[model samples]
Target: MFKRFQTKLLQKQVAGGYRLYTHPANASYVEKLVLSWDTRRLTQAALETLAIIAYKQPITKMSISSIRGVNSEGVVASLVLKRIVKEMGREKSPGSPILYGTSNLFLKKFGLKS
Candidate 1:
C-alpha cells in the first residue's frame, strides 16, 4: 500500500460528498506536497496575491497591484480562472472598479472559516 501511494499523488471521490486529494508519500516528511487532482498549482505570485486577497477581501484589483508594487493582472486573472478568487462586486469609487475576494475554494484549501 505504501509503495503504491509513494510514487504518485492520489485522489478519490467521497460517496455523496466532495472530492478528496492526498499525497501519502509526504505523510512523514516535513513539507506539504501538491496532489495531482488540484486544478491549479500555487506559484509564488499566486501565493502573494492570494495572501493579499485573503487578508483584504472585497478589494479592488488596483489596490492589489498597488500593494504588491507590481502589476498583478495576470495573477489575479489566473486566480479567478482557477476559481480561487472571484469578483465580489464593483467599488463605489472612480470607474466602479471590480472588487476581488477569496472564494469558498480558497477558504477550504487554506482551511479557513468563512
Candidate 2:
C-alpha cells in the first residue's frame, strides 16, 4: 500500500545515526514532538487511567473504579483532553455508558504499531 511505501521512504530519509539538531525553532518543535511522543509527559492521573483502559477496555468507569479502588473519572477526562484516548461510541447495554480506546496519536506517540 501507499502507507507502506511512505514508511519505507521515511525510514530511508532518516537512516541509522540520524540525529536532531536543536536551534530555537527546532527546539520548540522538538519539545512539542517529545511531549506528543512521551505519554509519560502526561499527568500521573492520565497514566493510571490509560493503563486501566488499555488493560480492561470495553469497561465502564464504575468498573474501573472497582478495580482501581478510586474514582477514575477525572483521569479519563484528562486522557480525552490530551487526545490519547477517544470515545468509541456507546455500549448497547442499559446505561449506554461511553466506550473508549487509545487513538492513533497514542500509538504514534509511543512508537507502537497497530
Give each model's whole-structure lDDT: 0.82, 0.73
Model 2 lDDT tens row, 1-114:
976455333322256565434445356666567556645577776777788887777667777777778898888876776688888778888989998888888887788897
Model 1's alpha-carbon lDDT is: 0.82
Best by lDDT: 1
lDDT of 1 by residue, 8-75 (tens): 66556678676545565556452222222365468998999999998999999889999999999999
Query: How well does candidate 1 score on lDDT at residue 70?
Result: 97
RMSD of 1: 11.9
Cα miss at 106, model 1 (Å)? 0.7
Off by over 4 Å in 1: 1-40
